[model samples]
Target: MNVPADDITGAPAELSVAEVRTAFQAWLHAKASELGEFRNLSTDVDEIFKSLSRLQRLLYSEGWIRLGWPEEVGGLGGPLVLRAVISEELAAAGYPPPFSFGTQEVLGPAVARFATPELAAEVLPRLLRGDETWCQGFSEPGAGSDLAALRLRAVDDGDTWRLSGEKIWTSWAQYADRCVILARTGSLESAHKGITAMLLDMDTPGIEVRPLRSMNGDDEFCSLYFEDVVVPKSRTLGEAGEGWAVAMFVLSCERGAAAWQRQAWMRWRLGSLAADASDLPPHTAGEALELIHILRLMSRRTVRSLSAGEQVGAVSSFDKLMMSTAEKFLFDTVLSAIPETLLLTDNESARDWRSDYFYSRASSIYGGAAEIQRNIIAERVLGMPKD
Candidate 1:
């Protein structure tokens, strides 16, 4: 956790963004050498979670994961872009970022913004230190695209609220210690205005988490059922009926800053494939490089705007759209240019490629569908009239 004296002196005194980036890159390179070789142990979802948790704990102990967070959350105060630099450096050094990085970027912002100060202080550090895992309980079987139509109900009972409904596509719920859940608190006629957000313990009574096996042969996503699950009123994020705003904030972070991390990984994967392939097609490398470039540029702008405290709003849909396009395009290029590596090779590297290729299909569907993003862009960004 000892930052170089030179870095401390330069920072905030005479340092520029470029200087910070350079120092951080050097620090990451040194850490990478110390961390040594990484092995892909198992493709099993549980094993992957365990491995990622261990990796997160290591990074947390090293202070890399706490760079951009507030000091109140056990972080060393720095621009949010410092965290992005960490992820980029890790990927550039051929290491997968710890899974908690995604949760921190996606959900941590919501908790910091909406949760009580005491709650943020108590729980944020646990998250930063890898003491717990969290999941988003926003999507339902019937409410993936139109989240306002979600039917999960939460009724206030003086001091607590009883929740009843199921959440589909809840990622890593089986391994999560906490969940940021959105439930209906008003009449159905209220739509988005009826919803409320809460942070719930996964171990609470009347809750069931059932893992769903994906095409990649992993159970990363799950179905969560609640039978009158009770949550304390103190767990509410923002005011009642304002869950839509909280949800929008989380989704903006997901599509904006999180997309930067995804683009970094895509760049690393492209480089790995280029190094491993012997007979790639004439245009395959060009196509893959172009896709990564486009994604990186789009994601960078989105990240910068978010870091500047601007209300990125629906403009982030562009980032989400580019991410889906780049991801699917890159993976498709890989599958076509190196079909043997994806389908026939038996080595661990090839297995990893195949698994990644399979998961890339969901890239367009998970956060929001590609079509949904385009629609948002057309209506909101382009000012197109709705049909």
Candidate 2:
């Protein structure tokens, strides 16, 4: 797709974060009536996805979402922090982010950094425009938190490689058009050193997606089964046997940039909880707000560091750990403040509350468990001895 015309919104190619935020907030206000519909969305995951996809398209057309992306890859060309402002301002305005927001931050960076320029130019725009959704196929049945132990195998076949493995807890794989998957191409004893990251089309033969129902009653997570699936050698990310670096980069984004998005959403939820819970104690609400603020500060630092091409390394573990802590605290406090609404009410708002509460229970477990985060900090950050 061609870059958005200058006359569309007349935004400069390079904009400061404040300018981007002011312009975006102005657009949101001017289009409030048009954007109001997204303030309240369906509880059904598929319906929510469909609705947000439209929102993403609208943002793309307006050029807000294109800011901070390179012109070579369908972006308007600015610092990445400009893109972060879009999601923050959207949530602050009571709008849900596009369905692919998390994937865009988590996987998009890795692909941009490691994929061939031709591949990045071809696919990144589709992802940014919400024309396609992607999933991360890192966590296997044997390697949820211990990602280095993944047993997925990818055997070389000259022009292509054959992948056979099972990936569990893959979020929204059922709706993905493509997936970035990690497979072992070396000896089992090689651990992380043997891994290779490859991008694959989800429609490829020998792939099966089974949606697993979460406690929220939404099939948000899925099991991806690949039986000798063929992937071109060209799709390999970085050099073979060097996937560990790619994986680390992806994890850093997942734990950092994605956390930025999550904290924004959490702050929105905190505001709603404060409004709904008439009897909520001031102290309880204050504490939750404090945790959320701490998360925002930490996540912002990480996002900016990433925008400047700095490696955050093990420091991102703190962001992941605090994110889960703040999320669980906010939802737990919400449960305490309005037990009846979350437990017995059948309305849309109540269902959202119930769903959020249930999903929050997994906050400590998903995306590298809290315990694992602590271990990383102890060993890598604090320089403490491992067990």
Best by lDDT: 2
Residue range 194-299, candidate 2, lDDT tens digits? 9999899999999999999988998879998889999999999999998989999999998999899899999999999888998999999999999999999999
Candidate 1 — which residues are off by over 4 angstroms?
1-16, 37-41
TM values, all candidates: 0.94, 0.97
C-alpha lDDT score of every prediction, in listed order = 0.84, 0.89
Candidate 2 versus the native: TM-score?
Answer: 0.97
**Model 1 over residues 1-387: C-alpha lDDT tens digits?**
344624443333234456656766676666665556343556666776777778778777666677777878777767777778778877877777777779999999899999988888888998888789999999988899888999999999989999999999998898899999999999988999999999999999999999999898778889999999989999999998899999999999999889999999999888887777777765878877887788888878877887777888887898898888888888898898788879999988888889899999999998889899999999988999999
Candidate 1 TM-score, true structure as reference: 0.94
Clashing pairs in 2: none
Among all windows of 10 consecutive residues in model 1, the one with the lowest summed lDDT is: 5-14
CA error at residue 135 for candidate 1, angstroms: 0.3
